[model samples]
Structures are given as C-alpha cells and as structure tokens.
Target: MILTLIAYALLAGLALIVYLSWSFSPRLTVGVAGLLSLFLAHGAWKIFRKPTKGRGYRALAAATTAGFTLTAATAVFVLFYGAGCGCM
Candidate 1:
C-alpha cells in the first residue's frame, strides 16, 4: 500500500489543481485538463489486460479505448454540474 496511497494522493492533488485552475482560468484550465485526461486514459489503456496482438493493433486498440473512456468521462462530468463545478 504505499504505492496505492501515493497514487490516491497524486490523483487527489491533480483533481484539486484542475478544480482551482478551472475556477480561476477556464481556457488554460480546460487545455491542461484535457491533456491530463488524455494522458491518464492512455496510460490506463496501456496497462489494461487483453489478448496478445501485434504492436500496431494493440496501440490502436488502446488509443481507441482511451478516447472512448475520456469522452464518456467528460460527458458525465459536464452533465452532472456543468464543467465549472469540478465534482469529480
């Protein structure tokens, strides 16, 4: 658990930063948030377990999955309380 704790702390810190950034400066906040979200999604996809496949195919699948996940997450986040609320 030290790793898990660190991970949770990091995610919490990121969420806090995102919230503050969104409240103070929406444009820059959105850009940063989007990039961060993409990075997280990509990383998660890369680590996901799946059947073995060619490198190119695996990369493509991961990217596609990440894109979908990000889209859905963004939608939920926006729908629950506008983008400004940062209610994650």
Candidate 2:
C-alpha cells in the first residue's frame, strides 16, 4: 500500500520534472525523457518477469509500463521533430 503510493509519487515527480523542462529546453527535456524511458523500460521488464504477488504489485507494474510507454513515445517524437524545433 505505502510502497505503491510512494512509487506512484516518484513516477509522477519524474514526469512532472520532464514536462516542466520542455519550456526551458526541449532538447534537454527529450534527452532526460529518453534516459528515463530506458530506466523505466528496465524496471517494467523486471516487474513483468517476476511472479505476481498482490494487487499492489500488479498495479505498480501497470503504472510502470504505462510510464515507460509514454516516455518512449516522447523520446521518439523528439528524434523525428527535434531538428526543426531550434532546441536540437
């Protein structure tokens, strides 16, 4: 329960930081998001590999998976459009 809440809070904090950085430097934001996507991909892989224990674990896994997907999408988008944005 508490652990899940903490995980969610940390995830939200990371996303919020990345989002807020966009206005300052889109390239920097994309770089950070790319790094975070890698980290979260590893986390999601580890979580999915483990056996299910409880609802909290499953919920955390789902949240991590979603975060990973979003960050990855953001990183990929930057790769396609970053050169034209003047931030690259």
Candidate 3:
C-alpha cells in the first residue's frame, strides 16, 4: 500500500517535471503521462497480486490502479480528440 502511494507520487513528480521541462503541447505531455500511468497501473496490479503476508495492501493497490487507469483513459482522449480540436 505504501509502495503504491509512493509510486504514484513519483509518477506525479515525473509528470510535473516533464510538463515543466518539455514542450507544453498536449501530444508530448499527455502521451508521456498516459504511458507512464498505464505502466504504473500494471505495476500496481502486480504488487497487489504478489504473495505477501499482509492482505491490507490490496485496498490501496486497487484504488490506485483504478485512479491511474482513469487518468490514462482521459489522457488518451485528450491526445486523440482534445488536442486535435480546431479551436486553436
């Protein structure tokens, strides 16, 4: 559970760094963030499933996975549709 939280925090920190250091374009920002989120979500699932003495870790992992999955989906939507809008 703690590890899941720390991983998410690290992901957020990395995203912030990318957003600040890289281009402000949605294609780059959202693409990187989305990919990272997907990877983290998978990692979280693995951590949850790994045999461990503590059963309490599942709750955090489940919640984190769901949140990351949602974020990834939204990022995909933005990359495909939101960023391509002709409004600009």
Could you give the candidate ranking by lDDT, starting with the highest?
A: 2, 1, 3
- Candidate 2's C-alpha runs over 4 A off are 1-57, 85-87
Number of the top-ranking candidate, with lDDT as the measure: 2
Pairs that clash in candidate 3: none
Question: What lDDT, from 0 to 1, does candidate 3 have?
Answer: 0.63
Which segments of model 3 are wrong by more than 4 Å? 1-57, 86-88
The 10 consecutive residues of candidate 3 with the worst lDDT sum are 79-88
Superposing every Cα of model 3 onto the true structure, what RMSD results?
12.0
Least lDDT summed over 10 consecutive residues: which range in candidate 1? 79-88
For model 1, the superposed segments whose C-alpha errors exceed 4 Å read 1-16, 49-88
Question: lDDT for each of the candidates?
Answer: 0.64, 0.66, 0.63
* 1 or 2, greater by TM-score: 2
lDDT agreement of model 2 with the native = 0.66
Instruction: Give the TM-scores of the predictions, in the order they appear.
Output: 0.37, 0.40, 0.36
| lDDT tens readout by residue for model 3, 25-85 | 7678778778777767775675467567856666656767777667667556444544433
Q: What RMSD, rounded to one decimal, does every model reach? A: 9.4, 12.8, 12.0
Worst 10 residues of 2 by lDDT: 79-88
Expressed as tens digits, the lDDT of each residue in 1-88 for candidate 1 is 5544554565567679878888899999878868867776765665575746555555655676777677667556444434233544
